[model samples]
Target: MQTLPVMHDADTEPLDDAVTRRVQARVGTVLRAKWRIDRVLGIGGMAAVYEGTHRNGKRGAIKMLHLELSVDPEARARFLREGYVANNVGHPGAVSVLDDDVAEDGSVFVVMELLEGKTVDALAEQRPTGRLGITEALRLADQLLDTLAAAHDKGIVHRDLKPENLFLTKDGALKVLDFGLARMREMQSNAKMTKTGNAMGTPAFMPPEQALGEWNRVDARSDLWAVGASLFTLMTGRLVHDAPTLNQLLLKAMTQAPAPIRTVLPGLPAEVAEVVDKSLAFDMNARFQDARGMQAGVRKAIAWLDKHGEPQNLVPVASLGTTSPGAVDSQMVTLKRDPTAPMAAPARPSRLAMIALSLGTLVLGGVVAFFVFGGSSGETPEPGPVASSSAGSARVGAPAPSATPSVAPIAPIEPARVAIEDAGAPPPVPSVTASAVKKGPSVKSGADFGEWGK
Candidate 1:
C-alpha cells in the first residue's frame, strides 16, 4: 500500500506516452538486407533501374522489370536469364550483375555495380572535333574487339552491338551493356521477334544476314560487320549506312560498299583505313573472320605507329580494294630513298639559275650558317663569297650543273589489296530473311524487324 504515495494516473500519462513512442519506434527496426532500392534512376522498355544500397551501405544499381512486362511469364524468364548471363559473363568491359530476385508482385529485379559513364550513343551525338584520329579510334576498337571476342568464344553472339550498347565508364573503361538479345549459338534461336516486326538489333549497324532476319545464320562474322560499322562511325562520326525503311536497309547491306575511310576521315593511315575497309565488306566472307582478326590488325597498326613516327605517310597497302589506283595523292609523290644505299650530294642550281644569274644570291642565311662553322676547321670547305649580277648579264646560255647523285629506278606503289568490285547489284539479293538497300552511300531497309523471323 505504501507504493510511493500513489502517483495519479494523469501524472503517469507522460511516462505512458514515452513508453508508447518507444514501442512504436521498435516497429521501424532496420533489418539486414542486400540492397535497398532508393529511387528510380531510369526507365527503359524492358526494365526500370533504381539507385540502391546494400545492407552495409555499398552503392549499386538495381534493375526491375517494368510493371507492364513483369507480368508476362516469358518476358520475366528472359529477364531473369539475362541477369544470370550478365553475372556469369564477367569481363572488365562488361557490366557486372551483383544480385537478383523476384519481388512479391512477381516482378524480377537485378542489382548491378553502379557505374558512372556515358553510352557510345552519347559520344556519337557529341562527336569529337577534327578528323577521327586513327590511334584513338583503333584503341576503342581494340577494346570492343576484346569484349566481342570473349562473348563469341563463350558461344554468345551479341545480336545488338550498336553505339548505344557501348559505354565508357568513369575510370575510362569501355563496357558493353544490355545483352538482352544476345544469343548463345549452342541454343536454338528464340521464336519471338522484336516489336519492330523483325529480329533484335539496330538497323544502322545490322549486317546483311541480320538485316534479312537470318538469326540462325548469324555467326562471328555478323559481329565483325557490326564492329566494322561501329569503327566507321567512330572514325567518321557518321553511320556507314542508313535507310528510311527496312527493305531499303537490307538491300544496301546486300549490295553497298562502305564509303572509303579517307572520304570522311582524311589522312587516316592507309593501313588502318584498309583494315576498316576489310571489316566493313558487304560479303561476310570478305570481312575479317572475327573480332579477334580485326583487333590483331588494329594492334599491328598501333605497333607500327609506336615504332615509327606519326603516320603522316602510310603507304597504302594492297589489302584495301575499295581504293582506286589514284585514290591517294601522297602515294603519287614518292619519297625516293634506299634502305641500303649511301647518302648522295645535295642538288645544285639548274638552267633557270644559268639564265637568271651566274651565281644565285646563295641564301644569306645558308651562307651565314656556312661561315659560322666554316671558319672553325681545317677540312672545312670555304664559304663562297655571295656574288650578285644584273638581269641576264652573264651565264645566259650555260648548262645547269648536276651535283646530286643519279637516282635509282624506284618501285611503283601497289594498289590497295582488297580491290572492291563495285559491290555488283546487291550480291544478287541472296535468299535470306532480311532485305536491305543501298541508298547513296548509306544502307537502308523496310522489313518489319519484329516479323522478319516469322
Candidate 2:
C-alpha cells in the first residue's frame, strides 16, 4: 500500500528528482516478457507501484524501486527484502508476490496480486466517525491478528502497522500490506536517520519499544502492540496516542498510557475495550506477549459483542468511494421532481366561454343605463339635495362627462301658450312675447310635456 505523502512547504524545497523519474516509467511498457505497465499508481521516495497486466491478462500491482534508489545498496536491499518477506509469508490474508526482476533501465520491480478494495483509512473517511461497527471492527482485527501470527511464524516482523497498511478486499476479507518495513532482523546502523533515536514505524501507531528506536526490542510482541493500536483506531475512531510533533509522540507513547477505548467511547462493550487497552500497554511485558494471545483476546471480544448485540453507531455508509456532498447512507440525491409531490395547476378557461362572458357584460351595462337615465324624457326630474361638502356635487349648469356618462339635467322652462291644432297632429307652440305669455298649471315631477297635452 502507498504511504501518505509528507507534504513540505513548496517555497521551502524543490520537487525531488525522484518524483520526475517516477512518471518517466512509461505506460504500456512490456516488462519481463509477460507484465505490461499500464499506469503509475503512486510513487514514494525510493520507488513507485504501477498497475500492470501479465501474459495471462491477469492484472496486478508492480512496485519498482527507482533507478536512483536501485543504485543505493541499502534501498536496493530493503526493496528486495520486502518482496522476499511478502512472498515467503504464504498467507491468503497477506498480498502474494508473483514475480520480481531487474528492468533493462536497472530499476528493480516486483509484481503483487492486485487487491480491489479500499484501504482501511479510506473506509474510515467514508464513515462519519472514522471507524467500522463493533462486530465488523472485531472481525477485521481478528483477521489482522491471524495474518500477523503467520508472519511471526515465518520470522517476519512488520515494523510499520497503521490503517494505511490494512486493506478490506471486495469480498470483505482483511489483507495486511506493505512489507517494506518488515524484517527478519533489525536494520543495520546505516539505515538509521540519527545515531541516537530514529524510529522506523509510523509515530501515531508505533509501540513504545519501536517509538524509542530500540530496533532490537521490536519483535513479535512489538507487532502485537501495533495490532492493539490498530484495534484502538478501528474501534474508537482515533489514534491510541496523539501529539503534534514526532518528539511529542515519542514522549507520550513512552510515558503516558493510551486512552482506554471506553474513555473515548463509553457505550462500547467493556470486554472489547479491555482487550484493545491491554494491547496498547506502554510496557511491552504488560501487553499480550504473542500474536496468538492477542488473537485469543480479540476472539473473546467478538464473542462478547455478538452475545450483547454490538453498538449500531459505528456502521458506516456502504461506500466504494469518497462520500459525495449531501449524500447519506450511500444514497445520492436526485434534483428531478418527486413523483409523490402534488401538482397544483389551475384549470384554464375556454376561448368560447371567455368571449361569451365579455359580450354578456356589455349587454348588462346597457340595460342598467336604460333604467338609470335613458328614458328619452323631455321633462326634467328635480335633482336630489346636494351635500355642499361632497367632491362630486354638480354645478348648476351641467355635469362633466365621464367614461360611462349620466344623462344631462334639464334647464327650467318658462310657461307658454300653444295654438290649438286638429286631432292626430302634434300641437304647434305660439310664439311667446312678454304681453302674450300665460301661466299654466304646475306639472308634477318627471311628467312628459306630451302626457300633459294629452
Candidate 3:
C-alpha cells in the first residue's frame, strides 16, 4: 500500500496510518461515474482533500473522509454537515460548497470551488517574520470583518476562526474557508450538530469564553475574538495566546491576558493597536458590539492615520477606553509600569471631556442665573419711565409716559439704572445717571446739559 501524504495539525491527530495509505492509493481513481480524483491535496484529522475533475472538464477540490473515519457514524455526520453549513452561508467570502454525496463504498465526499491562492498562513510565511505591514494588515482585516459581518447577519457563527481557515485569493480577495466547526443559531437544537462542552477549534485563536467550553454563551462576538487574534498574528507574527501544551494553551486563553500589540511591536500605530485591543477584550461586552461595528472602527482608525500621520508613542492603559466611533477614548494601550513614559496620557479629563464639562457648567450657570435674576418675584414692579432725550432735562421729571426709568420703581429692580440720551445732538449717545433726581448733566429739572453754559 502507498503511504499517505502527511499534512497534520498539532492540536488534532489524524486517523490510523494504515487507513491513510489505503485511501491515498486511490489517486487517479474515478468516482460517481462523473468525477475523477487526481491526487491528494492534504489530510486533516477527519478528511483528506483532493484535486479532482468532472468529465465535462470542470475543476474543483474534493473533500473525502478517510475510510477509517467514515465508518464512525458521528464523524460521517460532521463531514456532511460542513458542506451544508458552507452552502447555506452563500457568501463570496466563504468557500462555495457545490456538491456532496456518498460513493459506492459509503465513503463520503464534498466538492468545493478549487481556490488558486494561498492560505493566510502561507502568505505570512513570505512576509517579514510572518508579520505583515500596517496598511496591509488593516486592508486584510477590513475584508475579514466584512466576511464575518455577513455571516453574522445570517445567524451563523464561525466558531473556528484562524489563519488556516482564511484564504487569500490570487486576485487579492479574502475567502473565509472551513465551516466544519461552525454553529448555526437556527440549527443549535439539532442533535446531529449540537455537542456541548466539547469545543473544537484552534486553541490559540479561540476566545476565552469559547476556550472555557461555554458553548451556549458563544455568539457573533465570539468570532470577533478570533478576528482579533488573526490580525494580531498577521501583524506581530505571534499568537495572542501561546503555550507548549493543549491544556496549558486552553488555560492561558481562558485565564491570561494577551500582551498589548504595542508591547510586542512598539512601533505600531496607536489607532490600529487600540482597535485590535478592544476586539480582544476579555469581556465580550467590551468588544465592538458587532462585526460591522468593528469594520467601522477599523475604517475610522485607518482614515485617521491617512489624514493625520501615525504617532509613535505609547500611553497609559487606564486612559484608554473602547475606541469605537464617537467614544471619548482613543489613546489606550496596555500599561506596563511605564507611567513615566514621555507621552503618557494625562490624569485629568480629556480635552474633549473638559470642553464638554465647561459647556455644561456654562449652561448650568446660565440656568441658575435665570432663576435668580430673571425669575418672577412675589410682587410686580411698575413699568419704568421712558426718558425723551428730545424733550431735554425737563422730560426726566415728566411722569406722563416718558422714556426715563421711574425713580419709585427702583425699589423693585434694586440697584439697577438706565441711561438717557442727548437726542438733540448729531448722534444720540446715552449717559448713565447716578441719582434718580440727578444734579448731573445726564438729567435735569430745568438746567441746560449738552447746550453748555448759555
Candidate 4:
C-alpha cells in the first residue's frame, strides 16, 4: 500500500502519476524478489490493474486497491472478499486470482492471470447493431449461465452483472471478469441509476425486477431475465422493453411479451422461440431455475438448428449500420455515455460545504426576522386619524388609507438535512521514500475461490 501525494487540480500532472507510483511501490514490496511492474493496464473503482513480469520473466496482471477506497475498512474488506471469493471458484470461464495481500498503506492488492481481447461491452459496440447473432448469443449465454450455476449452488450471487463485467478472450472463450471485485464507483453508479426509470440491465437489457430495485431479492432467475434480454437483442436487433419513459418501460416489462425470436430473424426455428419465450416469461417460476436447466433449452435450440440446416453458428458480423446522417446506426447502435457520467465518486467535503452554506443562509434570515418582529410587538400602534364623511371638516384623512396592505408571508419550513459521513481526513504528506521489494504471502494451492463469492 503506497501512499499517494495529494496534488492540486492546477498541478501540471501526469494523468496517472499517483496510481503509477502506488503500483510500482507495491510491486517492489510484494513481488520485489519475484517481479517488476511495467505499465498500468486500466483503473476501476477500487483497483488499478498493471501488466507486470516476474524476475523469472513470467508475465501477469497485478491489481492494487485504489488509495481512496483502500483507506476505508469496509471497502478494503469487500475488496479482499472479492479476491477470496475468486480464489475459491475454479472454472474455465472464470478468471483466476493468483495471489493477494495488503500493502504497507493498507491497500488491498490481488494478482491475476493476464488476459487479452476486449470486454463484451466493447465487442457489442464494435458490432453493427450492438448485438451478436442467435447462435453466437446462445453460446455466450450458455457460458455465462454455466459460470453462474456453479456460484449459485454455493450461495454466491453476482450482485452486479453486465457486459463490462464479462471478458472475452482472444481465443473466443468467454471468461467472467471482476467476478466480485467490480469497482465501488461502478457499483454505486449502477445502484443510483437503476431506478424505476431505465431498465435495470441496461437501457434496453434491464429486467423487470432490476428496474424496480428488486435486485437484492434476485436469485438465479434474475440472471435468466438478463440472458433472455441479451438473446432477444441478438436475434431481433431491437430492444424488447424499450420506452421513452421509465413508466412505459416497466409496463412493457411486466405485461408486454417479447416478440418471438423468428419474428425478427426470418428463418429462425420455432424451437429457438420456445426457448427464449420460456426464459423471458414474466414469472420467474416459469423460467429455468438454474443454469443447467437453461442449458438444456439452449442445447435443444442448437440441436434443432443444426438438424434443420439453419446456420448452425453465426459469426459476429461487424458494421454498426447507418441510414440517416447523425441518426444512430441500428446495426452499430450503442447507448451513448453521458459526457459527465454520474458515477458516485468521492467528493464528500464539497457536498458538506453546500449543506453548510444553505444552513447558514437560512439561520441569518431567521435572526433578521426575529429582531423585526420584536420591535413591532407589544401594544399595537395607534390607528391613523380618520376623515369625517358628513362634515366638510375632513377630520383626519381616513387612517391615511391603511398603508397598502402587505401580502401574508409564507411560514418557512426547515429543510431536513442529510448528515454527511466524513471520508477520513487526509494523512500527512511524506518525504520521498524508495520502495523496498518484499514478497507477498503465499496463497494455498488448489484452494478454489468459488464463483459469485460463495
Candidate 5:
C-alpha cells in the first residue's frame, strides 16, 4: 500500500515534513529482527512506505503507521484492518498483504507485495496530452471494475478510488491499492470510527454523499461515482471539479454536477460518454446499481472501440515508461480514425439480418416449388414459352406457339447471393458472354427451369 505524493495545505506542511523526517531516519534499521528497511518509498498523511528485505531473502513493501497515529487505538486498528479488508476482496487485482507487525518504537506496519509498476497517475503524466488513449483508458477501467465488483460482492465499499490509488504493472496488470478508507458493511459496530460530520476521502474524487459526510448513504454506488470521476480525469487530464481552495473544491463536489465528459474530449464515443455520465448521476438510484452493471457498460465501450478499430492517437501503456513526455512512439501510432469524428456504422450486415435473409430465400424457393409441382397433385404443369435459338434470347411481340418445346435447365440460385441482394447490395453481373451463351444448350420451354429447382 504505497501512497503517492499529494499536495498538502500550508497549515499541514510542517507536520508532513516532520513525519517524513522521522520515517527517513528509519532507513538502514532492522524492524522486529525479521525485516530490514532499505529505503523510504513514499510518505502519506497516515503512513510511510519503505522497501523491506526479510531474513528469508524475500522483499516486500512495509507501510508503517505514523508514530502519532500509532498511539491512537482506533487509528492503529483501522490501519491494520486494511490487510483484512484487502484480502477479503479475493481478487488478483487487489495488492496482497503479506504480513503485519509492530516496530520497536511503537509504530505499526503492514507488509505488502512489492510491485514493479507506475501508478496510473504517473503513467498518464507521461503521455503527450496528459491523458490516456481511448483503448488504454478503457482497458484499465475494465480491470478496475472487475476488482471493484469482487470487493462489492463481499460487502466492502472502497471509500477512496483515484488514479493514484491504481497501479499499472510492467506486465500490463492493474492493481488496486490502499483499502485504508474502505467501509466494511458487516462491521456495523465500527460505524463510530468515522465521525458522523467528518468527511473522509480525496475531495476531487468524492461522490456527493461521501463529500457531505452522509456515511449512511455511502455504498457500492459511492465507489462507482469515484471510479467515474477518476476515469474522467484519466481521459481528460482535468479534475471533475477544480477550485483554488479545498473548501471550495468540496463545496463544488457536493453541489455541482461534473461537466459532461464530451465537453473535454468531444471526439469521445457517445456510448463511452454516456457511461461516465450515468455513473456521475447525483442520485444514487439513477447510477449503475452495482459494479457489475458499470462493468457491462465499460465492456460495451470496448466493443465499440473494437468495431471502429484503434484510434490514431492511441499510446500503449507499456511504452509510457520508456517514452519521453510529449514524444509519440512511431511503432505505437495505430490510427484507424480520428477519435473526434462521428462513429461510423459497421461495414457488414448484422448476423440476425443475414439469417433472416437466408430463411426468406428458402421460404420463397419453397413457394415457387409448390406452384411448379402443382401443390401435392403429383403432376407437372404445362410449359409457357421458350427461346428457339441457341442464343437464349426471348422473342418480342411474337405469337404463342401451338406446341411447347424442350429447354435447357436454368442454373441454381446461390443463397449467399440472395442474402447479399436482400441486404441492399448491388447484384453481381453475370460472367457469361454472348458467345458463351450461344455455345451453351438452348432454352426450348419455361418448364425446363423447374428441373433445376427439383
Candidate 6:
C-alpha cells in the first residue's frame, strides 16, 4: 500500500494511517467514467480532496468522503449534504459544487469548482510579522462579513469559520470554503446533526456557545464571534486563547473573555477595535445581532481609516445595502474636509440671470447717457467736463465721437465711475456697449466674477 501525506492543521484532525493509504489509492483512477483523479490535494478527518481532470479536458476538485465514514448511512448523508448547503448560500463568494456520485468502492465524491489561491492562514504565515496590514485586514474582513450576511439570510449558520477556510484568489477576491459543519435553522428542531454536548469547530475561532457545545444556543451570532476571532488572529498574529494542549485551548475559549483587540495592537484605530471587541463579546447579545449590523460596523471602521490617511486597496464586495442601492449610509459616503483648504465657492447664477443683469446694467447706462448728453432732440450739448479721449476710444461696440463735433461723447456710468474712484486709481474707461451687453461676455474657466459672476 502506498502512503500519502495528509495535510493537518489546527482546524483539521489527521486521518488514520490505514485510511490515508486507502484515499491515496484513488489517484489515477476514474470516477463516474469522467473525472480522473490526478493527485491528492489534502486529507481531513471526514474527507480528502483530489485534483481531477474530466475526459472532456475540463478540470475540477473532487472531494471524496472517507471510505471508513462512507459505510455509515448518517455520515454519507451529512457529507453529501455539503453540496446542497453551499449552493443554497446564493453568493458568488461561495464555491459551487458541480456534481456528486458514488465511487465503485462505495465511497461518495463531489466535484467542486477548482479554486487557485492561498488560504488566509497561509498568506498570514508568509508575512514577516504573521499579521496583515490594517487596511488589507479590514478589507478582507468586510468581504467576509458580506458573505456571512448572505449565508445568514438563507437561515444557514456556518458553525466552522476560520482563517484556513477563507481563500484569497490571485485577483484579490475572497472565497468562503467548507460548509460541511453548517447548521440549517430549519433542521434545528427535526434533526440534530450534533448532539447538544458535543463541541464542534476550531477551538481558536469558536465562540463561547460553540466551544462549550451548547448547540441550542449557537446561532448567527456564533458565526460573528468566529469572524471576530479570525480577524483578531489576522491582525495580531496570535490566537485569542493559545495553550499547549487542545483541551486547554478549548477550555479557555469557553470560559475566558477575549482580550480587547487594542490590547494586542495598541495603535489600531478605535473604530476598528470597537467592532472586533464587540463581536467577541462573551454574551452573544452584546455582539452584532445580524450580519448586516456587523457589516455596517466594519464599514464605519473603513470610513474612519479613510479619514486618517489609511486608504484600503480592496474594492467593496457589495454595495451599501445588499438589496437596495439607494439605502447607503451617509457616514460611509461622507469624507472629512481638509480644514486648511479654501472654502468652496458658492453656486454660480444661471445663464438667464447673468443675461438679465447685463441687460439691466446696459439699460441704466443708456438712460444716464441720454440724460447727460443730448437726447432724441439730436442737438449736441456744450463741451462741459468733456470725457477723456481714452474713455471714448475704449468704449466697446460704440462709434468714436465725430471730429466735426456733430456726435456727443459718452461718459462712464456713475456707479462704474464710483467703483474706479473708490480704488483711487487712474480715470476709468467705458467698456460696456449696447451691442456688447446684448451678447454677454464669455465665461472662462476658473475666472471669478465675484458674487454676480458666480
Each model's TM-score? Answer: 0.58, 0.63, 0.65, 0.56, 0.65, 0.64
Instruction: Write one digit per residue (lDDT tens) for candidate 4, span 1-454.
Output: 3232322111223336666556555544435356566654444333556666767776777777677777766556655666656655556776777767665566667777777655554556557766666677778878888887776666555544555456666688777755442222234434322222222233244455654445345567777776776677655555555455434444565456665555555556778877887887777788888888998899888877667766544332223221111121111001112324344443334555556556654654454344434467566546555455421222253222222232222344432111121135221111111111111212111111111110
Q: Candidate 5 residues 242-279, lDDT tens each?
A: 56555566677777888777776666788888999899
Worst 10 residues of 1 by lDDT: 443-452
Report the lDDT of model 3 for residue 210: 74
lDDT score for residue 28 of model 5: 91
Ranking by lDDT: 5, 6, 3, 2, 1, 4
Model 2's alpha-carbon lDDT is 0.60
Better of 1 and 4 by lDDT: 1
> Residue 115 of model 4: what lDDT?
70
Computed on alpha carbons, the lDDT of every model, listed in order, comes to: 0.53, 0.60, 0.62, 0.52, 0.66, 0.65
Tens digits of per-residue lDDT, candidate 1, 1-454, equal: 0111111111122223333232233222221345665544433334445556788887766666645567776677666666555555557766777777765555568777776655554554444341245576678778989988888788777776755567666577777776655676544544343212243455567776666556567788888888878777665655665444434444565457777767766667777778888887777898899778888998998877677745553232233333221121100000112224444444555566453443333333344455445556657654454434322122333233233322222344332111011222221111121211111111000111110010
Runs with alpha carbons beyond 4 Å of true place in candidate 4: 1-35, 55-57, 128-130, 181-205, 243-267, 311-454
Q: Cα deviation in Å at residue 405, candidate 5? A: 99
Tens-digit lDDT track of model 2 for 190-240: 443212334445556677776666666777888887787777676666666
- Model 3 segments more than 4 A misplaced: 1-5, 8-17, 191-196, 308-454
Leading candidate by lDDT: 5
TM for candidate 6 is 0.64
Evaluate model 5: give its lDDT.
Answer: 0.66
